[model samples]
Target chain A: MKTRVETVAIIGLGLIGGSLAKALKDNGFCREVIGYGHREPSLRRGLELGVIDSFTLDLDAALSAADIVVICTPTLVAAEILVDILARTEALEQPPVITDGASVKGNLERAARSACKEFPPYLVLGHPIAGSERSGVEAARSDLYVNHRVILTPVAENSSEALALVSDMWAAAGATVVQMTVARHDAVLAATSHLPHVLAYALVDALAESDESDEIFRCAAGGFRDFTRIASSDPVMWRDIAIANKAALLQAIDQFNEHLQQLRRAVVEEDAAGMHETFTRAKQARDEFAAILAEREQAKTS
Target chain B: MKTRVETVAIIGLGLIGGSLAKALKDNGFCREVIGYGHREPSLRRGLELGVIDSFTLDLDAALSAADIVVICTPTLVAAEILVDILARTEALEQPPVITDGASVKGNLERAARSACKEFPPYLVLGHPIAGSERSGVEAARSDLYVNHRVILTPVAENSSEALALVSDMWAAAGATVVQMTVARHDAVLAATSHLPHVLAYALVDALAESDESDEIFRCAAGGFRDFTRIASSDPVMWRDIAIANKAALLQAIDQFNEHLQQLRRAVVEEDAAGMHETFTRAKQARDEFAAILAEREQAKTS
Candidate 1:
């Protein structure tokens, strides 16, 4: 099974990149796993942690040695690095199947399409819906993507073989792979991931800057901590995501704001029935989501 | 220490009430624990579970027998119940030191004041910063308040002995007690707990009402689960809380909306630097809060 890909290169050496390298090695998805990052220290740490078999400074050399390339950098940086990789790989006798682990897909797809004269058929866009508040190579783990959702937004021009390889790589990492258009991927992720991130950050920032900040935080309990847990995520990466998925994110924020306004009105008017209705619906929906997640976990174990 | 109170009466027999009864009995805070509720089944469940030594629907008899009373009903119902208890105990030879576990303090305090020409000095207002999504006597636990914060908001009229008795009871339940004015408690809680609940409910409601709800929830991961965990909380309880803490909640919501608008503007303009700053501050703040909570937990066990 590992012979399908002799070597795999993961760019960025961050949590996702390092985790992917370790998962690939642990699952025997590839014969060797190499890591590349903008920072030499992170690459060194990845090597020290045994997340990768080797580290590469040169993108061209890394691409040349690998059967597949996984871009795991921030969304903005990923776009530029991906474009550069496409350009460098264009002259290769056999270009490797390329994929990314960015949170947003639409902007990356457009950027990739425009960067090359003819969009590469081997470029498969993907975003694994898995991460923790902790970042960098030190926090990477082999089981980070186990039973997580990995969404691939492949363009019409992408080769079936390339898509299959990308899908198989993630599957080997213990992720469940699903495919959709770039638009659909961005929209769904905006609603599920990006919007929640925005809300958490905004809530924390608002409270932190308030007059009663100290007391507010002191009284905050388990629910408050869990609600704002994502606010501790990597800021620069989130910033990039917010910008790259601007349209979908903005739409999500607007919808959320409108719903909040309705709730606020009910609170102000002392409309108990209205508030109860909204909260009941939300509770039912959240419970349903929890049930589905539990079923998925059970299915995976079974 | 157990002789401080001969018999403790818990009103509501729900999660908080049942848990308090169990904790009180487990810690020898009282000779016996008695439960009262509007519903006979819940009171029966409390007695059957041994959270209470006896069950009663007759509040007058329960009040007459108990040395201390803990009100553990919903926010709205708590206000009315506290007032009724005060009125019923007004002519008694010895009134029980009364305290409540309602989330909001201001409304309850006002109701207690208005229900009697002169509020009883034995009445103490409190909010325990502990709960689970689960409800009712079946979900009650003896350790629910262990190492948790319990905020006490005593008015000028509250007797020092009454305050001490209330504080000692919570301490016996393993809670750390803090004192604050009703206004401060309400403001702090609105910023911390109530606003987060509103946001979670609104976010879930928005997504649930959307056409892409199923797909959105399908891809939702750990962050989403934690973010919306409070949305599954009791709808009627939360609705009552929203109305009870309307002013402060509305103010918190407004501030959050302003912060979110700034974030929205940054996203719309692709202001990477602005977004990064806001996200960085939020991350730092959230991390600090988490560290404080960890320290508190460590302190408790040590």
Candidate 2:
């Protein structure tokens, strides 16, 4: 029989942390899920929503008696929290197996390694690839990660048990756990996530500043809404993500620019053949992706 | 007071035509909406679904008896159909004023002017800025144009009665009609509509062709879905639009490429300040657009 983790300490009850708390609570995976937030209002709201059984603002108090601690703060804030946890718990012989739920992993992994010298081999890096445009505890949902991919990038020589625990926790919460190198994670996200946001933001800016701005807005339909919806995302969070994944995002942007130039050329030359090929390829890719997702969904139901 | 036309003719029974037929029928704007489709199956399905009161394959039968004619075929196909109509009705004394429903106006306007020389003063061009990814008569909805924009691009010296009749028809079907020059309409739509579809199709294709195809598919969520939803749109239809609006689309794509390169440079050089400014401007633009939409929606409800 698998041992149940009775207590989980979730630091930072924002969208991610609050979601994890709700998922853990609903699954009956943890008997007590505690939430810690910087502000009193969030802590109270987290409790009120039943995302967490208890709440606190003190990191030491929040971490002292926990079986597992998941830090779900902004990337830089997560790094600072990891350092603070290690500094305070340096004297303890038995510190919790800590993993962070930050989007970017490379920087967080390096910071975690550097701060926790005696590292219980406890630091398992994870990113639950799930979110909403609406933020905070109120927007958190228990099924946010259901059937979603949760990536684990454990450091070399990390304890196998800690890794399994993190993987199993996400599995229990209904995510498909996959393992990859931290660098690969960042690189992949640059194309799939980060770079798209940059493009969406930039496209919105270009159209808004143009002389035909009002006309563009007036004519925008569902397509425009879908393309620019992400621009409504938290600017600060996006800025942090952009800075953290700078290298990979820049590379992705370069590839996109080249492809975009080809489109421009085809358009300028009024090359029907080239335009047909470009849109045809895009249509095929999206259809194939939709097919894969639909297959997975079918398999689960069957 | 606007004349209440008892009979209306709708050519082509696909997504747009079918939806417009249903909208007009549901709103009780006309006694009957006659449809025409070259394909027997589409004609049968449209009639059975009540998307059209009846349909005919005979070209003259479809056009000669109707009071108002709405050409809802593909842009190029619609242009071809306009020529056929003009050739058949050349000897008619009181020909019905023709209005076309195509995305790109300049090309269609030119075609109308050339083909309908005998009925010179009776052509008005319109575009209902509303649609869905799903195609065919099955996807038709009566409320498809609810609170949507319908842009009218009447050529200079066109009859005011013709423009008023077209505008009133759309307004009665629950749309806000706006007027613009054909050149301005094409340029605005190139930025707001065509560029988005092109980029979406291109991005998805680029990712699918890469070795990281499976990983990209797995990581795609709401953002990817939203970004590439239009990529799954009718491929032939998009190809036609891209070709028709090639000039403006090319210019927009070039502008997007320039903006993308600027973003790439900021990321590559780790220019945090520059990145912040870019993101902030994009955010402001998106927010402003959203605010405008919200205001318009509020006005409609109020």
Candidate 3:
């Protein structure tokens, strides 16, 4: 049987939390979806859009009512909030299960570790591998996580019941649940998502500061625009992520720099063979990745 | 009035040449479209697909019957072919107006200058800023250049007749013809197109060579796919571009390296303010670029 919650308290109402609230309510996975945030306009918008049943400024009130609580703030903020949630629910007879939607998992893992000797049973650390460039409650939708992967990095102390409940909620919202170690999650994400964002931001920032900035912007075509799309993502959120996943991101950056040097040497010496081999290897990998995505989509619909 | 040609000889049967052949035929701008290439299968495929009306293995035969000749090959090859075309057509009563679709203009510029005291009046240098990840004659389509910019870099010796004919051909194919100096075109493209391609190729190649490549590959999502889309472009073509646009590209690379160093330092020191400022600037630039695109698209459709 699928697990259901009586109440789900969402600590933030940005895209991830707002979309989850909408998804859970749409699927009837929760009896009441209560939002907790400082922003009044977004909470009111959530209520008007039928994204949440109710909302409060009081974190205690929301946690008191919820059977499950999801912290969905930026990474550093989410880590701090996780600590507060752990402390506030310490004495309760049956405290709410807690999870988060932060991009980086190491900081959350550390926060959870600080509150427990081994690992907190009810603190089910997670990162739903789903989002859009748009943010906040205004952009929330039920199908946001459909056919997407929701990665849950469960600790040793995670209660089976807590894991089941979180998994069922995600499944109800049309997401495929996968498990990973927090360390592995951080490293993989640094290479794939965070690193790409950094390269794009650096490229754009560099070009913007160049002497020929006006001419540079005028000549940017479809490919340049597409490659830099992710650079337009939220700055505060990325800043938080860069800090939260610092070690792994730096490692990825260093690796990329070394390879870039090799490429630069080839270009400088006009090493046609060296450039061809690197490009060929990348093309094969990218093409394979594309095929995998296609197969996964086909599997979902099939 | 639109300029018309009796027979147009495309000296290469790849995407650019094939598409131009298709577009000209589709618009009735030319009486016959003849393809010149060494590959029999591709030339046959071009004929079967109606991308070209006739095929020729002999460059001399193709040049002999043509009112116009487009040397559309990889950059280096295009330069060599330009020299041969100049020599053959040197003794003709009225040499066909020549142009090319090479990405980098310097090589072509040098070739033209070597053959004449000034830029050959009959030779119009051009680069159409339109392409897909797909290439070759089989992937060609008539609408490839529609709504795209075709930049023509005319020299001091370019006759009014040659320049007008080349501009009219591009206009007939649904491209907006723009003019720039050879140096400006190379620099602008190095910053906008070549730099981004190098970064994407480097990122992908670097990740593919990492220890956790399997796990990293598994976690790559839509944004990674979109950012790396251009890395799948033909390696040989890019290699030629890298060598052909060497000086400008190296200058762009050196500039980018400095900015990347600043970003790396910010990340290493955990300078939240620095990271945020850079990301915000990039986001603002990206957003404005997006707005400009939307406006241009709106203007086009309206």
DockQ top scorer? 1
Which stretches of candidate 3 lie above 4 Å from their native place? A113-119, B26-28, B44-50, B114-119, B299-302
lDDT per residue for candidate 3 within B1-302, as digits (tens), equals: 66788999999899999999999999989999999988989999999999999998998899888988998888899999999888888777788999999999998899878976556789999999888767899889898888778889998888999999999999989898989999989989998999889988999999888887877877778889889988887888899999999999999888888888898899999999999999999999888888877776776677
Candidate 3 chain B worst ten-residue window by lDDT: B293-302
TM-score of each: 0.94, 0.90, 0.93
Record all residue pairs in model 2 with backbone atoms less than 3 Å apart, i.e. clashing: none
Ranking by TM-score: 1, 3, 2
Report the candidate with higher DockQ, 1 versus 3: 1
- Per-residue error for B112 in candidate 2, Å, reads 3.9
True contacts kept of each: 0.95, 0.68, 0.86
Estimate, for each residue in A75-124, the C-alpha lDDT of model 1 and write its tens digit.
Answer: 98989998889889888779988999998898888887788877789999
**How would you class the docking of model 3?**
medium
- lDDT by residue for model 3 (A49-152), tens: 99999999999999999999999988898988888888888767899988888899998888878875556688898888888867889999898888888889
Which window of 10 residues has the lowest lDDT sum in candidate 3 chain A?
A: A210-219
- Show model 2 residue runs off by greater than 4 Å: A25-31, A48-50, A53-56, A61-63, A89-92, A113-120, A292-302, B25-32, B48-54, B88-92, B113-119, B291-302
The whole-model C-alpha lDDT of candidate 2 against the native structure comes to 0.83
Per-residue error (Å), model 1, residue A210 = 2.2
Q: Which pairs of residues have clashing backbones in candidate 1?
A: none
Clashing residue pairs in candidate 3 are none
| Per-residue alpha-carbon lDDT of candidate 2 for residues A68-159, written as tens digits (9 for 90 to 100) | 89999998788888888878776768777788888888878777668766544777889998888778899998888888889999878678
